[model samples]
Target: MATGLILIFDKTHFSKYFVVPSTLGALLALAIPDLEGGAHDDIIYNGLNPNAVNNSKKYGINWGYDSHLFWEFLITHFLSLVLPFFLQIIQPKEEKITIKVLWKSIYLTFSVALFLFFFSWIIYAIVEKHGSPAQQISWNANWFYMGHKGISTLGELTKWPYNIISLTIIFFVLFWLVFVIKIYFEIYSFNLSYQNRKIRFFYIKRLKKTVFKENVIKSKH
Candidate 1:
């Protein structure tokens, strides 16, 4: 998947525009989940590690209290889809890029990033109070996952409402993987194709070394 995305962007004229923005979007998708009331820690310590004590309980953190997993899944996935377009919208109209445009771009990128995060957080807050009985019960049950082999929510996913919620989360996770692939290509293509003097020299030197090793192996064979 990453190889395919790299080929697509590397062959395109707009690769530069795609790289930074898509990388940013992928990073945000990876990070926003951390704010879900430390459920990740619970999953690790409680679910994955049988011998480990229940960290959430020890720390007195209310389990799954801040997790509107379904909503979070939606917002971040949606934002990743639209982030590239939003970045384009904020680009200056002037043909020549200037310092001012650079500054503005930085400012707008941060603004959009913040807006995506806060918008999801706000939605989570508003609707959290109205979580269905199934959601509440499942969350409590799944929290501090008592030696589960999979995700904290894995057990809950077998039942109603939780089944639906888990499905939504899965949908978004697959959706976000596309942008993550682009991030890999962004780093890869930068190293392989960038023309900057220092970067080009470094990659060229590495390539020569690799080719030299391959030739030595072929000669021995």
Candidate 2:
């Protein structure tokens, strides 16, 4: 098999049609509350969006666990792609025959996403504890708040070991997210043949032997 470089999209179109919109979408999705009530979901979606809730009911829209899962995947994948693009890092594109690339991508994505989630929690705590009453209320009114309310609620629960429980649940959720991403890559690879394999990979360039020889000769003088 030939070693090749993969180009995802046009770099020139980064500002207009690509990265900006995706960044916004991922942020918005991250900021949206989960549909059903659960401790982890409550932690993530500190304040539920009433409008979203009303719309779902009115339109008969089934925005549940699956919808949240998709957003999580989008967030992970977007971070994986956008962060590398901005840093001028080139990741090996996923080849159909090799899953090594997929594993690498997922590992990086999961690490970054985990760091971000923890960072968000820290910020939430700082704001809730130190901010003014209005600030605290407004913060909890948004989906990003995961401070006193959620944690305190868990704390109040019949003296249960919620901290340990929450951590355990978090571990499983993250594992599941990685599994879902892997499955997605597998499906995409399986479908490549019928789609004309739009993914393009180019060989990495290297200097010719003559040029290297000339450089070495010049350096020796």
Candidate 3:
């Protein structure tokens, strides 16, 4: 999601205008839940250590709490769709962003981020020991890992996959920051070129009108 947002805002064109408000919606989606005493939805991770998994009594936010899984799921993902829809309605046609661009941005960013995640997963598999012979390692896909992870949230502090995943996330964020910065400058330059063309076109148009007026007056004389 973070990477997706970065991609969306990578242009000075409609992307920034479109991306920012939508991002706000996303932020609100995340923040409102926590503010209203809700917990973030997360993945339920089967731990490498049985003791750690046992420590996590629940997989995610308390089921009985005000933060129900249903609402959390809706708010976190769907609310973002509203912002772009409203922007499309009120925003000018020329400045409008296309769904293709949005999808491309999201796909490109996700591909890069996913690479990091998978790469780290490989490292973790090699280095991190699985649970004891009697313990089973399992991951719940209900949340699809976009949310929070299993019981040992704090217990992740001592785990091996913990650091690798953390590093992977951090790497994506840093790489994404640099990528956005480059795109920002490119967007600025692109817009500047457009502005220059508009200015030149305006002068050429005035010149044509002036010449036409001069010819009409001469003909009248």
Candidate 3, residues 45-94, lDDT tens digits: the string is: 32244234432344343543465675666755665645455544454353
Order the candidates by TM-score, highest first — what do you get?
3, 2, 1
Please give, for residues 1-221, the per-residue lDDT of candidate 2 as tens digits.
Answer: 00111234434322211222233334443554333333334333456554555443332134444677556645574674465345322432312212233344335444543454465566667777797644554554222122333333234531222332453354336544644553444334432222465665433333444344432343344
The C-alpha lDDT values of all candidates are: 0.40, 0.40, 0.40
- Runs off by more than 4 Å, candidate 2: 1-97, 137-221
Residue 153, candidate 1: alpha-carbon lDDT: 28
Cα RMSD of predicted structure 1? 18.1
**Model 1: residues with Cα > 4 Å off, grouped in runs:** 1-14, 21-104, 132-221
Clashing pairs in 2: none
Candidate 3: lDDT over CA atoms?
0.40
Worst 10 residues of 1 by lDDT: 141-150
